[model samples]
Target: MFQDPGVGVFQAWDYVVFAALFVISSGIGVFFAIKERTKNTSKEFLVGGKQMTCVPVALSLTASFMSAVTVLGTPSDVYRFGGSFIIFSIAYTMMVTLTAELFLPIFYRSGITSTYEYLELRFSKAVRMAATLIYIVQTILYTGVVVYAPALALNQVTGFNLWGSIFATGIVCTFYCTLGGLKAVVWSDVFQMVVMLMGFFTVLIQGTIKNGGPVAVWKAAQEGSRLNVFDFDPDPLRRHTFWTISIGGTFTWLGIYGVNQSTIQRCISCKSEKQAKLALYLNLLGLLVILVCAVFSGLVMYTFYAKCDPWTAGFVSAPDQIMAYFVMDILGHMPGLPGLFVACAFSGTLSTVAASINALATVTYEDFIKYWFKNLSERAGTWISKGLCIVFGVACTTMAVAASYMGGIVQAALSIHGMCGGPMLGLFSLGILFPWTNWKGAAGGLLAGITLSFWAGIGGFVYPAPASKMMPLHLNTSGCELRNSSDILTTLAPTMAPERPALADSWYSMSYLYYSAVGWLATVIAGLVITFLTGPTRGGDIKPVLIRPVCNLLCFWSEEYRKACWCGVEHDAADMDLSGDYISTDILAMRREEPTEISKKDGKDSGDDLPGHIAEDRSYTNAGFTKDTDL
Candidate 1:
C-alpha cells in the first residue's frame, strides 16, 4: 500500500558509499586471487588450504547465514509479534556448543572436504549423494531469498530497478567467490560485517534520537506492548512461545550450524582443530550482537511509528519494508546515511550468497564431478570449481527474481531450511550419535523427513491461518495527522479477531517455527524403526572415529561397559575388523593398521591409496578412539 518514494532520496554521496561496497568487495577478491595464484589447487580454493585464521573464519561463519533475513525479518517479527524472539539466543548457544563438542571433532579429524562425505563413510554412497542433492537445493533456494531481500530494500528506498539490482548483487557475489574462492568469501565477510553493524547502529541511534532518547524509545515500546520477553504457553500451535522458540529454534540452528556445508566449510578452514573450536565458540558472540541490534531496531521502529502505524495506514507495502520507511521518514535528509543502510542490506546478501555458491561449488566438485572424472587434474579441478561458482551464481540470481512473488522473505527462508536442512541434520545426527543406524535407515529417514516436511509446509501456505490466529499485539493509528475517526477505525479493523479455523486444518495451521523440529523428529523416528526392521549396524562394523563419545562422556556406564560400548566390543578388541561391505578397502586397511607403524615406515602402508591427510596419520590410533593427527 506504500508509495515508492523513488531514487531521489539517495544523494550523490549516498551513491558513492553504495558503489564503494562493491568496489572494496571485488578488490578483496583480486587481492586473495593474486596471493594464492601459485597454489591454485581445489583444496586451496575450497577450504583456504586448511590454513585460515580464527577471527575471519569466526566472522565468516556468522555472516554467511545471518543475511538480510535476520537484518530485516527479525525487526519485522518483533514489531508484528513481540520481542520474545530474542529467546533464540538460548537456542543459538546450545547449537554452538553441540557443534563445537560433537560435530566439528569428527569432520576435522576425518579430513573431509565435503560435509556429506561422512555420509558415505558412515552409511553409503547413495546416502552421500542424497544428502548432497538436498544441500544444493536448500542453499540455492535460501540464497535466492537472501539475495531478494536487499533488492527489495533498494527498490523500497531508492526505487532502483529490482531485476537489475538482483543481477548486480548476484554477479558481484559470484565474481568475488569465483575469483578468490573461500579466502575471498571469508575476508569479504569480515569487511561486510563491519558495514552491517555500522548500518544497524545508524538506524538505532538516529531513530532513538528522533523519538526523544532511549528513555522515550523504551516508553513508546512499553505503551505499544512491544516489550514482551517471556511466554510460557504450552500450546504447540502458538508461535514464538518460549518452548517453540527455545526447543524448535535450537533444532533449526543446529540444522544450520551443525551439518550445513556453508558453516562447516568455514569451521574446517581453521589452521587447527583448536582454532576451529574457538572460531565456532566465538561465533556465538557475533550472532548475539547482530541479534540484539536487530531486535532493538524493531523497538526503535515501533517508537517512531507507534502512532502512525505505517502498514495499517497503508504507507508501507509489507512489514519488512518498515525499516526502510522509517529511514526515509526520519533520516532521508542526512546524505549517505540511507545509502549506508542499503549497503548494509547488500552486504548481508553478498556474504550469504557468496558463501552459498562457494559451498555449492565445493559439494558439486567433490560429490558429482570427482566421480564423473576420476582422474581430473588439480588445476583443472580448481578452474572447474570456479566455473561451478559462476553457474550457481547465475542460478541464484534467476531464483531471486522468482522469489519476489514469495511472501515474507523470513518465513520463506526458514521454511526452505526446515524442509531440507532438518532431514540432513537428522541423517548426520543418526550417523554420529546412533551407531546402530544403517544405510537403509539413513536413506529411509531422509526420504520420510523430506516428504512430511514438504506436506506440512505446502499445506500451511495453501490454508493460511485466519486473522484471529496471528495474535498480533495492540497498534494505534489515531495520531496520524489529518486522518479522521473513520479512517482510524478502518485502519484498526484487522485487530478484530475472527473465528478459529476448522480442526481439520490444525496441522496446516501449526507454527512455522515447529517445521524443523517436526522434520527432525520424523527422520529420527523413522530411521530408528527402519534400522530395527532391517538390520541395525553394529558398533564393530563402524569405525570408532565416526561416532561421538556420547556414551563415554555423558552416560554413567562402568569402565568395562563403556569399553564394550566404545565400538561394540571390549576395550582390547575395540579395533575389531572393519572389513564390512559398506566400507572401502583403503578405509578398512587404514583402520586395521597403526598410525605409529605408518610413521615408523615413513608413511608407506596399506593406506597408500587414501588421501594425504588420512594416509599420513591413518586418522586414529590402534585403540581406534584417539585422533593421531590434527587437520
Candidate 2:
C-alpha cells in the first residue's frame, strides 16, 4: 500500500502563486470599482447600470452557482455516494427554465432593484421585511459555509491554518466589493469562471491521462458501481433515489434561481429580457458541463487511489480533501500547474463571495435601511451600501470560521439556502398569483412557513433522540465496514452498533431538496387559508401591473373598476401616449378651445393639462416607469 502524503507536501510555490492570483484579480476588481464611483448612480451601483451582456451575466451566474463548496465538496459527494448525484442536474435545468419564463419577466417589468420588492407589491410591508431578513440570514450562512469548505481543503493540502485562509479571502472579497459594486462583481466573475474552468478541466485531463486514459477510468468506475445514475426506488428515506432527487431537487433549484438575489441579480442586470432568457440557457449548458467534469474528476481520483484510500490511510481526515489531495500529490511537480489550480479555486471562492456581498449589501440598503430612512440622499445611500458590504463581509468570515468545524460543508450551505428560499419563492408566487391575499395573511403565513421549516430542520438537533429508544423509525440503521473475509455480515459486524444507530450530521445527510417543498407548501396553504378566512380587499388597492403576467392573464379586470381605478390606468391607454412632443402645442390648443363636455367625455382634459414638472416627469415615465416607490 502507498503511504499517505501529509500536509507538508504543499510547497512554497503554491502559496506564492495563490497570493499573486488573489492580488491580481482583486486589483482588477478594485480598479473597476473606482471607475464605477464617478458614474455610480443607484441603478448602476446595484445592478451594473442594467446594461450587462449575456455572456458576462451567464459567467457570473455560473461562478456564483459554482462556489468553493461546489469545487471541493462535489467531488467528495461523487466519491462517497456514487454518481446518482448527477440526477440533480435535471432539477436544476427545470428551475432555470422556470425562472426565465415565469420569474424574470415579472422582475424586469417591475424594474425593481431587489427581488423582495415584489413581496411589498403583492403582500404587505411586513412580508417584504420578513423575506429580506430571511434572505440576509440565509445568504450569510450559506456564504460562510462555502467560504469555509475551500479553506478546509487548502488546509489539508497546504499547512496554512483554515482560519487564516478564511480571513485572507474575506478581506480580499470585502475590499473589491466595497470599492466596485455590481460591475466589479460581474467582471471579476468573468475572469474567475475562465480560470476555474481551465483549472478543473486541466486537472481532469491530467488525472485521466495518468489513469491509463478514459477507457480504463470508465471501466474502473463501472466495476466499482460508480456509474449508476437511475435508481427509481419509491423510498423517501433514501437520499438519492430518482423520485426524491427530481421532485425535491427541482424545488431546491427554484428557491435559488427563482428567488435568491445572488442568482437573480445577475439575470436582472442583463441589457434586455431576451438576453436574460439567453443567459438562462447558457447557465443550463454550463451546469451540464460542470456535472460531467466534476463526476469525471471524481471517477479519475477513485481509479488512481483505489488501493491507497487516502482518508482511511490518514492522509486526509475528511472526504472533502480528496480532490485537493489528488491535485497536490499528482500535479505538484508540473511547473505553474499547482499555482493555476489553486488560483482557480481561490478565484471561484472570491467571485461568489464578492457577488454575495454585493447582493446582500443591495438588499440591506434598499429593503431595510431605505424603508426606515425615507429621505436619505443618493450619496448617503451609496455610502451606506459600501459600509454594509464591509460589515457583511466580516460577518460571513466569522461564520466561515464556525463552519470549518462542521461536517459536510456543501450540504449544510445548500440546506440553509433551501430552508429559507422556499418561503421567499412562495411569498413571491402568492404576490403574483393570489391578489386577494392581504398583508396580514402574507405576513402571518410567511411567519408560519419560516417557523415550520426551521423546526423541521432543527428538530432532530433539539430533541436529540427518539422517544421509543428502540432505533428511531426514520433513521437509517445500515453500516459499512472493512471486511477481513468474504462473509458480508461478519465484515460489517464491527462497524455496526449493537443497540443504537448514529444520526447523520451532514447537511446533505437528510435530503435538502425536500426543505423548499415543505416551506413552499406550508406558505401557500397557510397564506390561502388565512386569506379566505379574512375578507378580500376592494378594487382600488390592487396593482395589476405589479402582479405576475401569468396571474394577470388568468384574472379578468372589472370594467367599472378599470375605468375609475388608478391601478389599471396605464393599461387603459391604447398606445401609451405619455410622450411630451405634443405637450406645448396640445396644451395651448386645449386652453384656447372651449371648456365643453367634449373634452371631459373624451378624457382630453386629463391628457391636455401638462404642468411643467408633470410634462417632464411624464416624458421620463414614457421612457420607462421609475422604480422609486417603496414596493
Candidate 3:
C-alpha cells in the first residue's frame, strides 16, 4: 500500500535536522581549527595530538567505517536474499583478531602516523609510494560511493535533486575537514554516529511495530527462505557461499581495518597502545550491534511488503530505493520521521567521506609531500594539508556522480575497497612475513596484484549475465497493478541465474565475496614467486614481532621462531616495543627518564612533553625548523 510519496517530502522539521547537523559540524571544525592554530604542526593537525580517548576514538571508528552503503545496502541485501549477510559478524570477528593480534602491534610499536610509512622503513620508498597512491585512489573512489549511495536514496525519498545533494554534502564535509582537521572529524563523527544509531533504531522499531512485531517479521522472512545464512557451498562461482564470504570477508576487513590508513590513524591517536586496542574492540562490538539492527530492519521490510510489495506493485523504481520507499510507506505521515531518515542516511555519508578526506590529506602530506618539500614551514604545511583535504573532498564528490552507474551500493563500495585493499594489504604482508621481498619484488607484486584485482573486480560488471531469481518468502497480487510479469516480486529470479553470453567466462563470474582474498592471494603469490626470481633481497628492515611466527604449535613449540621467518630477529623482553601490554622495571625506568631528558633539553621544561603517551613531538622540526622555534 505505497501511498502518495510527496507527502513524505522534507517538512520544516526535516530541514531543521539537516541544518543543525551542518551548523554543529562546521562549528566544531572552526573551534578546533582556531584552538589548535597555535600548534601549527602537521602532527597536531593530522593525528589529534595523539592524546585521544578510547570512547570517542572508538565511536569515530564506528562512524567512519559505516558508510551509507552499509546503512542502505545491507538492509536491501537482507530483504532481497536473506540473513546470509549476517555472516559479516564472522568477518568482523576475524578482522578484530587479525587486527589486534597481528597488525595493531606492528603499526603501534612503530609509532607511525601514516600506515604506509611503515612500508618505507620495511622495504623501499618505491613500495611506500606505491601503497600510498593505491590508497589515495581507493579512498577517492570509496568516498564517491559513500556519498552517492545515500544521495540517491534521499533523492528517491524526498524528490531532492541528486547532484545538489552531492555537492552540498561535499561542500559541508570539505569545509569542516579542511578547517578542524582530525579532531573536528572525530568529534563530529561521535555526534553523527549518535544520529545514525537513533535514526536506524527508530526505523527498525517503527517498522516492526507497524508490520506486527519482531516475531512476525522473523516468521515472514523465514517462510520465504530468505532467512538462510549457513550455506557451506564450496563453489567459487556461486555468489554467497560460506567459504567465499567468510574468508573473503576476513581478508576484506583485514585489508580495510588492519593495514589501511583510516583505521590505523584512529588506532594510533589513542592515548596508548592498550587504549587503541580498547577502541578497536569497542568498534567491533559497535559494528556487531549496528549490523544486527540493519538485518532486523531488512526482515521487517520484507514482511511488511510480502504481499503488496511496492516494487512488485510498481511503486518503486530500483531495488536500492526499497529502503527509502519503506521509510515513506511506514513513516510518511509522521511529521519528522522522513526527514530524520534522510538525515540518518546522509550522516553515514558525511562521516565516512569526512574521515577519508582528513586521513587522505594526512597520508598525502606525510608519505608523499614532507620529504619532497624539505623547506616547507609548519604554517605552509598546515595550509597545504587543509588544501589537500578540500581537494580530495571535492574530487570524491565528483566521483559520486559516476558511482550512480554501479549496481548496488554495498557491492560497489566493497568492490572498490577490495581492488585496492587486496594489493595494498599484500604489499604489507610481504614486507612483514617475507624478508626477501625487496622493492623489486614489491613493485612487481603490486602491479600484478592490481592487474588481477581489477580483472576479478570489473570483469563481472562487463560481462552481461542473466540473474537467477529466487522465490520470496511471500507475495500477493491482491493490491498490485499486475500490468506485467516483471513487476511480480516473488517471481523475480535470484542473483545467481544470470543470462549467459556466448563467451561468458565462468572465471569472471567468480563471486565478489571472494574478491579480496583472490586479489590478496594473487598479489602475494605473484610477489613471492617473483621475489625469488629477482634474486631475493635477504633479511629485512622489518621488526621481529612483525614476522614472529606462531611459536609452539600443538605442544611442538620452541624459541627458534627467530630463525624461522625474517631471520636474525629474536623475541626478547625488548619485544615490548611491539606490544605495550607488557611492563617491566626497565620500561618504568625509561619512562621516568623521559621527562628528565625533556627538561634538560628544553631547560626549564618549556612544556614540550604534553602528558598522555608523550613522545618527542615531531613538529615543525621535520620541515627544517628546530625544536626551539620562537613562539
> Largest TM-score belongs to which candidate?
1
Model 2, poorest ten-residue lDDT window? 469-478
Tens-place lDDT per residue, model 1, 128-207, is 99899989888888899999998888888888898899999998999999999999999999999999999999999988
User: Which residue runs of candidate 1 sit more than 4 Å off their true CA positions?
Assistant: 1-8, 481-504, 553-557, 567-631
Task: Order the candidates by lDDT, highest first.
Answer: 1, 3, 2
CA lDDT of 557 in candidate 2?
Answer: 68
Sort by TM-score, top down from the best = 1, 3, 2
> On residues 1-21, what C-alpha lDDT tens digit does candidate 2 reach at each position?
122543236566766777776
Candidate 2: how large is its RMSD?
Answer: 7.8
Model 1's number of clashes is 0
What TM-score, over all chains together, does every model reach? 0.90, 0.82, 0.87
For model 2, the superposed segments whose C-alpha errors exceed 4 Å read 1-3, 6-8, 460-510, 537-540, 549-631
lDDT of each: 0.81, 0.70, 0.76
| Every candidate's CA RMSD | 4.7, 7.8, 6.1
lDDT of 3 by residue, 356-446 (tens): 9988998999887876886677789889998999889889999998898888888888888888898888888887667667678888888
